[model samples]
Target: MTEPQAREIIENYLEGYNLFDVAGMLSCLHPAVVFENVTDGSVTLRTNGKDAFEAQATKALALFMERNQSILAICLNADCARVDIKYFAISAIDWPNGLKAGAILQLTGQSVFTFRDGLIASIQDIS
Candidate 1:
């Protein structure tokens, strides 16, 4: 894949994600896609393959009443793309940890995307 191809794919994925459109997001991924979420140097979530990714994404749909991910910066090579992100969301329901519904969540993070067969093969989100 070319750098421009990677950028377009990433943008498409982000568009789907912001809209909570799981199917659209999946369209940019390889069938064997691997996904991970890293927080403070530890892996908080990992999903292997599209089925697992779909399950996770579907579950996440209910956690936020609103969500958006804005790309701050992005660089892409044939093999991969790295993006800095500003994320904002509002909780849809109370959490066990005392986060109440309507609470605002905002954070900055980085996401790495690797490509295979002209599609995203892996995504690692770090914060």
Candidate 2:
């Protein structure tokens, strides 16, 4: 796909995620996909295929009592992209993890996405 088309596809995918629409988010991934989440100093959550990835997403959703994740900006390169996301994730209702009310945890992270045939073939993230 063209760069603009890929950007739109990614934007839509991000929008779907912020809305907690799992199905919508999964639609952007290829059948044979590799998703890597590198957080907490090099441990990776790797999933093969869309189904596996969806399962991981579901687990993450279950952990949150409330969450609102937003994409601040997106920059697309040749077959790669970076997105700045802002999010508010709460583990449980009325359980404060030292976060203030209405506080947005600003995350300036980047993910490299490789597309094959207009679908995401690989996604590697770092914060």
Candidate 3:
């Protein structure tokens, strides 16, 4: 797809995500969408298809009281777009990892997106 088209799709998805709106996010993804999360050079999570992705997104919706990912930059290639983002959030509750409720979390990350039929087909998030 073209750059602007791809960017608009990505921005739409992110807008849904930042609002914890799973339905809106899923509207921008292909039916067979695949999602992966990588941390410290290792893949920590993988979800296939829109259903699985929706489930994960729903679960994550409760992880933070407020969260946002501000796009820092976006670069386009033949069939993929990479987005650099700054993530900030306030924990909604205590976590097993010792992150307590009300704690502030911040990080920088990149998300690589690929599209199919004008919708996002795959996503790899790295941090």
Give lDDT per model, in order: 0.97, 0.74, 0.95
Q: Write the per-residue lDDT of candidate 1 for residues 9-106, one digit (tens) a residue.
A: 99999999999999999999999999999999999999999999999999999999999999999988769889999999999999999999999999
| Candidate 2 lDDT over residue span 25-86, tens digit each | 88898899899988866846789999899999887765555666566777777777776666
Colliding residue pairs in candidate 3: none
Name the top lDDT candidate: 1
Which whole-number lDDT from 0 to 100 does residue 60 have in model 1?
98
Model 3 poorest 10 in a row by lDDT: 61-70
Error of 2 at 98 (Å): 10
Return the clash pairs for model 1, or none: none
Candidate 1 residue 81 C-alpha distance from true site, Å = 0.8
Q: After superposition, how far is residue 108 of candidate 2 from its true place, in Å?
A: 2.7
Go through the candidates in order and give the clash count of each: 0, 0, 0
